[model samples]
Target chain A: MRIGVVHETAAGERRVALIPQEVDGLRKAGHEVLVETGAGVAAGFPDAAYAERGAVIASATDVLGAEVVLFVRAPGSDPTLADALLAWLRPGQVTVGLADPLGAPAAAAALATAGITSFALDLLPRITRAQAMDVLSSQATLAGYKAALLAASRLNKIFPMLTTAAGTLPPARALVIGAGVAGLQAIATCKRLGAVVSAYDVRPAAREQAESVGATFVDLGLDAADAETTGGYAAALGEDFYRRQREALGKVVAASDIVITTAQVQGVRAPILVTAEMVHAMAPGSVVVDLAAAQGGNCELSEPDTEVDVDGVTLLAPTNLPATVPAHASRLYAKNLTNFLKLLIVDGAVRLDLDDPIIADTLVTHDGEVVAPRVRERLGLA
Target chain B: MRIGVVHETAAGERRVALIPQEVDGLRKAGHEVLVETGAGVAAGFPDAAYAERGAVIASATDVLGAEVVLFVRAPGSDPTLADALLAWLRPGQVTVGLADPLGAPAAAAALATAGITSFALDLLPRITRAQAMDVLSSQATLAGYKAALLAASRLNKIFPMLTTAAGTLPPARALVIGAGVAGLQAIATCKRLGAVVSAYDVRPAAREQAESVGATFVDLGLDAADAETTGGYAAALGEDFYRRQREALGKVVAASDIVITTAQVQGVRAPILVTAEMVHAMAPGSVVVDLAAAQGGNCELSEPDTEVDVDGVTLLAPTNLPATVPAHASRLYAKNLTNFLKLLIVDGAVRLDLDDPIIADTLVTHDGEVVAPRVRERLGLA
Candidate 1:
């Protein structure tokens, strides 16, 4: 099979679908790989590197001629590129990457009209065997890690403690609102930086995890045992429960020098943890990193992807922490892509076996039809 | 000291510092509690409830004249009310609530200079003794739970599986990137909703937690032995480790239909987990709940507090998921505040011994100065 890697045309994106090293892996797997000129340059993987790795460097036009066209962000992300790709696409050729399919089902239909097989990675099923292929988890780890770094850098005080010639500097206190991956990482990172960390979670089991992370668990004694749904996610609490919980947390919010909140229930708006009142309670020069700011903010004063000085506290809602460290983020994403390729490509041929749980589950559009039931429902296709 | 509860003046904020029922505990502890008219109306508690609970309803001016002022948020949050309170504040009075001390340290200092002692709920320490008083953790629990609900609500597919009259709906696959409070809630909620859940964390110890919540642990095969620091938080992994981690996770992301990424490193940017390429690899109509959207987003296409469709995947970054259910959120916050109040108000008198670890650690400012060392350092006050 021949795979072509195109330079992403998405705005603010510098990552390539296939870096030179990944190309080598493809060659080792007995597949031919082609790279558009300068696809990997921005990410520090030059076109020459691809050639050295047994990849053929080609123009975008030549690259798209292959059996499979890969990209970090597909043409759907860039309408101008989408038009060009639709015109250039050959029958039976496969297109893969983030294609914005739901937002532009018309584009998916267009691909179908052109007789092209397109795979939208965003629809991958969550399963054990597919763990290695999960790009979301891989990238999330980076985002979680980066959020802590951004907070620490912008924080007024050092995260860790120091006992130099001066008086002993007590460890900075850090409060992580959510005990999710990012919150956990924040706790871990803060602890590493010698900050005293505490965390909270709605699920009963999170208490133990918080304690294990050396963070004292803050339990708001709400009858939340029933708050957990069978699928292991938190069921939305009643208004009564939330009122009680917030009252219990008020003190903690006021005491911490740095509060890193990563609280969100699935599919809902990000909860406003740091109310304007809470912000007022914090000392001057306190910093709050609201990971949920985009959703509306854990802090009431938080503005998405922006930093605001509320009273004396600095509330930062960074929108793209992962992009700040593109090199590592891209590398991780590329590896996820490689692993995914390994699953669908067997013996150098792309196989779409509906019987395979992994394949059947992740397949949304197949043979020019939206086959996934959920997707069909969302698109009102049924 | 007679404690008085004031209604919040911030627009759209309905939580009261103390619910009428909560005042019973304070009264039982031998403290006289006063409630401002309509303080608990939005939280479903009426002034009549306070009268029933042996509490006196008073005007805002009357409440501010009490020896101690209690509120959901501090004066900075409701400048108009705070100004009124300041006018009536006598020297040596005490004020407690979410003060936003760091954001509004000057305000706190102003109160202190006026001979009023202030305690910021945001400053509560993460310690065992202070756990009950930890307002941040309690509210975070709600935020985490709320995030999962938001994701599930907006998701195209049902969270759990069902053997229907037509056929068996395979269990929805949910991947929670972070294992913090919100991530755990998402996992628990997803599991309860009948989805197969898998979770990832940088800290090796989080595996036990993930499993406890019925989530399969997704290990990326990295040497994470050093991932945790002494304080039990995640240590920042070197770039090399992050590279390998991303590679391992890419495969997992490619298989999940619902990827709720809660990976946030404190004070930094949210890591980008779902790249445009990764999203493309997913099946169409997938949903990505980027809880870290405010910090930049775990998904490449996520816009802060908005929903973006990438290749048929819905990237929802709700900034204020909790606010969506403000009634409940407010209730939880009230409870947290009540618990914190119990810690400081002993026998109708405000205590500021500073000998207690919880109190000492949480004190951000005192006597018109930023007494907290961390706050001092943040302000460059040596």
Candidate 2:
């Protein structure tokens, strides 16, 4: 089997599909690897490093010609890149990565029409066996860590408590909305920085997880028994539930020096957890980072990829946070892809086993049709 | 005694001379407090907050007319503001704050000519009695914390180690140069962020302080019995010693993912510890923060108040780090000023007790003469 790694063409997409170490793993498995020149440069992996790891440094066209191509974000993630890659893509060629299959199901339809077998890692099952190949969790971990760091850096005060001769400087209070992978990591990072952290999640099951990370889980007194989807993500509550949740969260948000919101529902617009009125009530010099900015934000005032200042409160909604920490993001993402490839490649050959949920669920477009049921439903092909 | 708080006129200076809490303290001490309108606004204290603390909100003219005026950065710290302030200042009026007496000795000369009895807190002696009045230590603490936060935020990787299914991410290695208050605080902060921290300082005594803050002290085997001045600061080392020190530090600098340089000598240029060659040898995603950038940076490539990228390595030289964290900076600074005020105001009147070293040393100008020996020597007035 021959693997190909191409440079990400999307704007601000710095992550590479496979790093040199991952290439080493594939090469040791009796597979050949071709890397597009400078594919991993932005992610801190030089072409020389790949060459040193028994990977061929080839041009984009030569790399793309390989049997199996990998990407941090497949062409479908960006429409412009999708069209360009579509022109070069051949029938029966396998492409694997995060293609935003649900968000852009039309991209899946196009790949099927082009007779390409595409596996969208974003549709990876949340089961334990498939956890190693969960790109969302891996990337969310980095996003959460970056969110806490960004908030701390932007806030006009220190996070930790200090007992200097000048006096005892109190620790800044932080609130993490949603106790998922990103929010838990955010809470933990804030705690590590010595900030007193509290977390709020719609799912009651998330209370233990949030507490395990040293956050005081706030009970909003809202019944949310059906708040979690089967995919283990926050289900989109109705407007009335969100309205009451916001009212209850307003006081907590106003008291916090830093608020990191990661309340994102899969394949839908992120709920407006932090309203403009809540932000305005926040004390001067407060900082809010919305991790759900790419999904239209958890904070009402947050503009995707923009920093907005509202009444002395700093609101930052960075959509592609993983790109900012590309080195680690690429490394983890490559590892996830390598683990997933183990199931896709059998005996050093491409073999799709539909019986395996991991392979069947992630297989977005196979055999000239959009095979993934969720993606098919989203595209109205069902 | 009427104590006045004025808005900082220095560009990029957001810290106020006093906050509402400090104003309350003065009121309880039976002293009338007058604050210039909007003085503490940038520092997060509204006029209403100040007025609630028994402080009279007044125009700049009314506040300046008070017997004693406090400033975060006094007129002498900024020349343009100095000229404007000099016009309004009256004889026998006592002014206090960081006037940068040594950096701009002429400012002290002008204050002396005007008979405006000014105290420069930057000249405070390193004595136990004056610990609470040490503005340099308080500000340095904030600068160190900010430097670590900036480095962590800018780095392309997370600080802490994680053994996720994606694989283990090793903790980032951080090297901090100079183990003074700022350097030690930076070391502590990086450690809190779970970075593997190592520190290097010219003075051997700094080893204990660095180690206390969870940093492994790196000894370069440089012998200097007189490395520290009587003021307990790093003394000026000639180019010969600096060249050798840079050579010895090259390997450490190259290996570090983050390097925070805080090496500074009082009344002299900071030593260039990290050369361009050393920086070039560092990994592509490395970060170098020069806390001494304002004093001509310890890194060869660092520019004051600028972020410079050299071969994928980020170099930041923030001159006014404390000003960026104005709320707490102002709070701590006000505490230091209030402590110093206890000595200056004797029995509700301005009493210059020249016998007290804390009072005498910080007093830059008194009775139409540059009385401080150091200021007089710097001005060539002896």
Candidate 3:
């Protein structure tokens, strides 16, 4: 199998789909890797590093001629680039990467029309066996880590307590809203920095997960027994429940020095957990990092990729935070891709095994049709 | 004693000499506290907060009319503002705070000409008894912590090592040059962020201090028996020794993902520990923060208050880092001032006793003369 990797053309997108270490392993498995010029440069992996691992350096068009094409962000994720990318694709060629199948199902229809077998990595199943191939989890970890770091840097005081000859300075208080992968990571990071950390989640089972990460779980006295779905993701609750939750969380937000909100619902607008009034109630010199800014924000004041100052408080809504820490993000993402490829290619050829849950769950378009039922339904196809 | 606090007028200086917490104590000590309106506002202390603590909010001129005036950065520190500040002072008036007496001896001379009793906290002696009054140590601690945080935030990779389902991502390597208060703090901060930290110092005794803070001391194999002065500070080493030291440190600098340089020689230029060539040899996405940027940086390529990118590596020389974390910085600084005021004011009146070493050491000008020996020598006064 000849796998191709192209440089990401999206502004501020620095991650590479395949790194040198992953390319080395693929080469050892007898797969020829073709990387476009400077494909991994922005992610700290230069062309020389990739070439050193026996990956051939080639032009974008030449690399696109391979059997399998890998992308950090599939061109279909951007409607403007979808047509240009589809024009370059040939029938029977396989495309693999995150194409936002749930959010932009029209991209799946476009891929189907182009007769391209597309596997949207964003649609990977949440089963334990598929955890290694979960790009969302890997990328979310980086986002969580970066969010804590960004908040710390923007904060007016140090996170940790200090007992000096002058006096004792108390540790900062950090509140993490949402106990999912990103929220847990943010809690752990804030705790590591010596902050007194607490967390809240809509799902009751997330209490243990939050506690395991060293955060004192906050019980908002609201019934959320049906707040979780069978797939283990948060389900949207009633407006009244959210209103009451916000009212209960107002005091906690006011007392906190740092607030990191990561309450994102898959394929939908992120729940607004921190209101503008709550932000206004927060003490001066407080920092709020809204990780769900790209998905309509968990904070009412969040503007995607902007740092706003409101009455001495800092509100940072940085989108695609993984791109800021590109090296580690790309490394973890490449590893996820490598694991997925093991089930994707067999004996130097593309093999479609719908019986495998991983393949069946991730395959969005195949044989000139949108195959993934959820994506098909999202596209309103009969 | 009527003590006055004024807002810092220097550019980028956000700290105030006294906070509401300190003002409250002074008020209870039979001292009338007068604060310039908006003095502590930038440091997160509102006028209402100070008023609640029994402080009088007044104009800058009214505050300066008190018997003694306190400043975060004395007007003498800025040449342009010195004359205007001096014109407002009476002959018997007293001034307190950091005036850079050693760096700008002319400031001391001007204070003498104005017949004002000036106590330059920057000239505070390094002694066990005077530890509580040491402004340099307190400010340096904030600078160090901010340096590490800035470096971590600027780096393109996360600091901690993680064994995830995707793969194990290794921790970043951090190297701190100069094991002073600032450097030790930086090492501790980087370590808290889970980076593998190492420190380097010319003084051999600094090895223990570095290790105490969880940093592996890097020995560059350069002889430095004269590196420590009797006053317990780094001494200016010969140019030949610096050349050899930089040569030996080149490889270590190249291997580090983050480098924080805090080396400084009092009353002189800071030593350049990391050369531009060494920074160039470092991996792409590496960050170097020069904490001694105000004293002519410890990195060869550093420019005060600027972020310079050499190839793909970032070199940040942030000046007055304590100002960036103003709330805590002001609190710590206020505590140090409170301690010093204990010795400066006896029985509700200004008491200048040259017999006390703490008073004698920090007094740069008194009774129409440049009294500090070092300041007199620097000013070439008879």
Candidate 4:
């Protein structure tokens, strides 16, 4: 079997699907690997490294002739690339990468028209067996960690406490509204920076976790037993709940020198936890990091990907923290891609076993048709 | 001492500082309470109710004449109101409410100039005595719960499993990333909805919590011994740890049909867990609720407050889940504010003691000066 790796054409994307070390893994698996020139340059993996790892350098056209094609951001990501790749795709050939199927349903359909079997890596299932192949979780961990750093960097006060010779500097106080990965990480990072951290969660079960992280869990004492869905995500509560929550949370938000809000419901607007009034309640010079800014922010005064000074407080809504640290993010993402590829290729042959949950679940287009039920509906294809 | 409640002026804010029942509590404490007419309209409390509770209803101007002015969103919230109330505020008077001190630091200073001592209820500290006053926690809990509901509403499949005549529709598989308040609530909510829920947290201690919530804890094998900070939050791991973590977590993300990413690090952007590639790998029709969408989302395809279809996957990033259900949210918030008011007013007098940790910590500004060191630094006062 032969595998081709192409450079990512997505703007600001610096990751490669398969790095040099992964190419070596493919070689060890008794498969031939082809690398387009400079595929790994942005991610700090030089072409020479791929060559050293037993990969053959080739042009995009030459690489596409392989049994399988791999990319970081494939076809639907860039129109020009999608057109170029469509011409090169042969019948029964396999293409894999992040294909924006919903954003561009036609792209997957195009692949079908070209008689190419395409698997969108973004659709991988979340299972124990496919843990290494889970790209979402891998990249999210980085985003969570990066959010904390971004907040701290722009924060007015130092995160940690210090007992200086002149006086004992009090530890900065940080309040995290959401207890998701980003919120938890923020709490942890702020704590590490020596800030006195406190966190709040809607779920009664979150108290223990918050406490475990050494942050005092602030409980609003509302009965939200009925607020959860069976799918393990927050269900939208009645308006009464949100009103009461904002009223209760306002006090705590005002006291904190730094406030980081990470509360967002799925398919809904980000909850406005810190209203303009709440922001005013905070002392002058306080800082707020609205991770939900892109969705309109948890803070009323927040603007997406911008910094706003309200009263004396600073509100920061960073658009992409992971991208800020692209070098490491790309490396981690590349590894995830490599792990995913390993599961699809066996003994130098691309195997599409619908019996395998992973393979069946991830295969969006097969036999030159949009076979996935959801994609079919989205594309209005019977 | 006389207490006055004023109507909130901030847009879309309907909560009042005190409900009719709360007014009764103040009266029992031997204080005469006055409320601005229609202050509690949004919370479903009418002026007549306050009158029935032996409280006086007056205009916003008249309400400011009391020794202590209580409000929902006032003073720093409305410059016009702040100006209008200036003449009514006497020396030694105190104003307490969800003041937007961070957004209107100058307004707080103006209170000092008016010879009034202002207590921003939003600045209430998270302490044992102040626990009931912790508004941030209460609102967050509701927001978390509401987030789950929003996800369920927009999801194509039902959350719970049911054995019907047709067959058993297996429970939806929900993956909650981040073990904070919202994440935990999301987990609990999903479980209640009859979904098989799994949760992940960077902090090792969160595993027990995940189990406690009846959700399976997904652990990516990594040395997270140093993952906790003294302040009790999950500390950010080094780049190497993130690399291994992504590799390990990829499998779990791929298996989930409903993936709610709640991972947020404080003051930072939400981590990107579901990359474009990861989304493409998912089975078509799967849904991803990037609770961190406002902070630029955990899913690669998520556009904040927008519903995007990636292949068959739906990426929903609604910004303000709480606002959608403002009724209950306000009620809970009012209760928190009421509880905090009780603590501050002991025997009909406002206490400004710096001895109590809760009080001292929450006193961000007083006597027309920025009192919080951290806040001062943020204002460049230090």
Candidate 5:
């Protein structure tokens, strides 16, 4: 199998699909890997670094037309370059990456029209066997870590308490809202920074998960029956439930020096958990990081890619935080993609087991048809 | 004694001379406190908060004309507003704060001409009795903690190593120069964040200080027989000695993922430790934070309040980092000033004992005469 890697062209996107370590593993498995010139430069892996790991340096034109094309983002996701990317593929060639299939299912139809077999990593099943190939979870860890770091930098006081020759300073109070992969990571990181951490979640099971990460579980005393969906994501509660949740959370928000909100329902607008009244009640010099800003922030005052000062409190709504820590983000993402590649491609030939749940779930388009049921139904082509 | 506090007029200065917590103690000591409106607003304390603590809120003019005026910055530091501030005070009145008298001795002469008693906190002696009144050490601790946080935020990797489902990530390598109050705090902070830290200094005594803060002391193999001055600060070395030091430090600087430089000879130009060629040798996405940027940085490529990128290595030269964390900076600074005031004031009357070493060392001007010998000699008025 000849695998291909190219430079990511999205604005503000700094991660590369395959790093030198991943390339070295593929070469040891008797596969030839082709890397585009300067593909890994921004992520601290230069062309010479890849060559040292047994990868052949080639042009984008040559790499994109290989048997198996790998990418951090789907080339067809960008409409301006969709046609050019589709034109480079032919029948029986495989494209593997996150193509925003849920939001833009039409891209799957385009890939099918070009006779390309596409496996969208975003659709990987949450099974035990697929844990190593979960790009979303791997990237969420980096996003969570970066979010806590960003809040600490913008905060007006130190995170940890200290007793010195001058006096003693109290540790900062940090509140984490949610218990998903990203939220758990945030709780862990804030705890490591020596902050007094507390967390809240709708699902009762999340209490243990948050507590395991050194966070005190915050009980709002409101019954959240069916707050979780069957797909391992938070479900959208109606307006009445959310109003009560916000009202109960006001006092907790006011007492904290840092608040990190990470609640989101997939393919739906994120719920507004932190109201303006709650923000106004918080003390001056406090910081709020809304990790759900890209999906319409959990805080009402948050704006995507903007830092707003709401009456002296800082509201940071940074979009695509993983890109800021590109070096480690790419390393973790490449490992997930590499694991997926090893599972699908065996001994120089592609193995598409139609009956396998992992294959059936992640395969969005195969052999001139929109294959994945969820994406196909979303495109109205069922 | 009627002690008054006013807002700092220097640009980007956010700290207040006294906080409400410290004001309560002063009021209990038989001192009438007068505070300018919104004096502590930037430090997260409102006028109403001070009033609740028995502070009499007044206009800037009323506060400036009181028996004694306290400030975080020198009223004479700003040339544009110096004359206006000096005109507001009468003879026999006292002013206390950091007045930069050593650098601008002419300001001392102007204050003396007005028959005002001036005491600069920067001249405080390094004695056991003055340890609790050391504002410089208190503020440098904040600067060091902030420098580590800034470096962690700017770097394109995690500070801690993690073994996750994706793979393992190694911890970041951090190097600190000058194991003083700031450098020791930086070393402690980086260590707390789980980074591999090493520190270097000219004085041999700094090895234990660095080791106590969990940093490996780096031996650069350079001679520094007289690195310590009588004031307990790193003195300026000869040009040949510095050249030799820089040559030996090049390899360590290039290998570090984060470099924090805090070396500065007081009242003189800071020595350049990391040259531009050393910066070029660092890997991409590495970060260098110059904490001495205000006095001309320890790095050759640093510029105050600027972020320079040389060959993908980021150099952050931030001036007055304590100002960035103003809430805690003021809180700690106010405690130091409060301790100094307790030592100087007796029976609520202005007591001037010229023979006391504490007063003799810190007093810059008294009764229409430049008093401190260092400033008098610098101004050619001895």
Candidate 6:
């Protein structure tokens, strides 16, 4: 089996699917690795670094012709890359990436027409056995950790209070909305930075996880019945419910020195939890990190990928926080991808075992069709 | 006595001399407080905010006309504002600020020619009774704390090591050069954020202070006899000593993930601790924060007041870090200024007692003469 890694072409995307450190693992598993020239440069890995680790430095065309190709981000959501990616790939080839098929299933359609087998890594089910291969969790961890740091950097006051000879400084208060992977990581990182942390989530059980990570859980006095879906994500509660939730969260937002909103609804437009009034009420030096900026933002005033000064408050709507720490992001992503790729390597060849739930769920397209049930159903194909 | 505060006109200076919370104390002491319109706006205190605290909002001209005027930054050292400051202020009016006269004695000369009583807060003596009035220590505390946060935020990896489901991440290593107030604070802050911190200083007594606040002191195995001056600052050891110090420190710097330089020699240029070659030897994605940037950066490649990428390392030369966090910086500065201002108020009037060492040391000019001995000596007026 031959594995290929290429340079990412998306704006603000610095992570590569594979790093040179993990190339030895692929070779040990009886696979040849081909890395395009300067593929990992932006992620802090040079061509010489990859070549030193037994990875062949090749041109983009040669690497694309390999049996298996990998990417951290794919053209599934970017319509501009659809034609270019399709033209570069061929039949019987395998592509593995967080293709973002949920947002743009049309990308899967293009892959199907090209008669190639494509696995959308984002579709990997949340299961114990599949934990190692979970690209979403790995990337979300980086995003959440960076989100807390981003808030701390933008804040005017220190996160941790200290009693000095001059006077005592009170620790900054941080409030995290959403108790998912990103939210929990944010809570942990903020705690590590010595902030007085409080987190909120509609799912009642999320309180345990938040509390376990040294964050006080804020429970709004509202019945959030069946707030969590079977997929272990927050269920959409409609506009009326969100409006009332925002109203209830106004006081919390105003009291907090830093607010981090990770209220992403997976494939849907992110819910606006922090309203304009809420943001305006925050202190002049308060900071807000909206992790859902790329998904239309969890705050009303957030402009995706830009930092705005609302009065004196700083609102950072960074679209790709993982890119900001490309070194660690690439490292974790490479490990997750290597874990997934290891599963498909059966006796020095690619194995498409549809019986396994991980394989069946992540396989977005195969044999000239949108074979994944979810993508097929999304495309209205029987 | 009437005290007035106007907006600071210095580049990137946002801190104010007084805050609204401390204005009530001045009023209770039988003094009138005047704040120029928008004086505290950048410091997170609006005109309405000051007005609510019993401060009268006045024009810049009226504020300067008051019996006593306060500033976080003065026209001192800035020739552009010398003539304007001299013209705006009339004789007999008292001006107090961090005049920066130690570094630029010529600035004190301009104030003396105008026949105004000027007090340079930076010249305040390091006595027990004057601890509350030490603006340099107060402002440096903020600068050091912010320096650590800036380094963490710019870093490519998290400061803390965590055993996550993905894998364990190692904590980042931080090195602090010069164990002054700013350096010790940086060490404490980096340690609080979970970075493994090490520090170095030429003064032997500085080791105890650095170690007391969670830092491993680095000794270069060189004879550092007579390293401390009478004023408790590092003695100017000349180029030969600095060359040997940099040579010994090269290995230590290359091993650290983040390096913070606070090696300022008061009233003189900062000694370069990390050279371009040393920076080049460090791992990619490392960060260096030069806190002594305004004094001519401790890193050879550092550009004061800007962020630069040297090879692959991020060198942040932030000037006036206290100004960047104007809200708390103003609060702390106000507390220190108010403490000193209380000493000058007697029988509802400003008292200038030459007997008080605190007053005598800080008073740069009085009665049409450069009165402070240090300023006079530096200006060749002795």
Best by TM-score: 2
Least well predicted 10-residue stretch by lDDT in candidate 5 chain A: A75-84
| Model 5 C-alpha lDDT versus the unseen true structure | 0.87
Cα error of candidate 1 at position B83, Å: 41
DockQ of each: 0.02, 0.84, 0.83, 0.02, 0.73, 0.63
In candidate 3, chain A reaches a TM of 0.97
Provide the overall lDDT of each model, using Cα atoms, as 2-decimal numbers.
0.68, 0.91, 0.90, 0.70, 0.87, 0.87
Better of 1 and 2 by DockQ: 2
Q: Positional deviation of A109 in candidate 4, in angstroms?
A: 5.3
lDDT of 1 by residue, A1-382 (tens): 8899988775556667776667777888988898889787665566787899899999988889998888666654445566677888887788777665655566666676677877766555556666666554554544555565555544444454533211233566788888766677667656654578888877778788777767888877766777565545455667677667778888998888788888765435666667788888886557888887645677778887777987557788875454544444566567667777887889888898878876675555556676666446656786
Per-residue CA lDDT of model 6 for B39-116, tens digit only, reads: 988877888999999999999888999999998887673435677778989989888888888787887888888888
Off by over 4 Å in 1: A74-91, A98-116, A223-247, A264-269, A293-300, B1-382
Per-residue lDDT of candidate 4, residues A256-362 (tens digit): 98888887664357777788999988765468888877556788889977779886577988654544434344555566666767778876677777888788876
RMSD of each: 17.1, 1.4, 1.6, 17.6, 2.2, 1.6
TM-scores (chain A) of the candidates = 0.84, 0.98, 0.97, 0.81, 0.95, 0.97
Question: Candidate 4, DockQ to 2 decimals?
Answer: 0.02
Q: Model 1, B116-163: lDDT tens per residue?
A: 777777676556666556555555544565565555544444454433
- Candidate 2, residues A216-240, lDDT tens digits: the string is 9999899988899897878988999
Candidate 2, B115-226: lDDT as tens digits: 9999999889899999999999999999999999999988988899977887889999999999999999999999999999999998989999999999999989988778
DockQ-based CAPRI category assigned to the predicted complex of candidate 1? incorrect
lDDT of 5 by residue, B282-380 (tens): 999999999988778999998888899987899999878888888889988889888888877878877777777777788988899999998999889
The CAPRI category of model 6 is medium
What is the RMSD, in Å, between candidate 5 and the native fold over all Cα?
2.2
Instruction: List TM-score per model, in order.
Output: 0.48, 0.98, 0.97, 0.47, 0.95, 0.97
Per-residue CA lDDT of model 4 for B118-195, tens digit only, reads 766655554456756766555555456556655554444445553322123456788888887678877876776567
Give the Cα-based TM-score of candidate 5 against the true structure.
Answer: 0.95
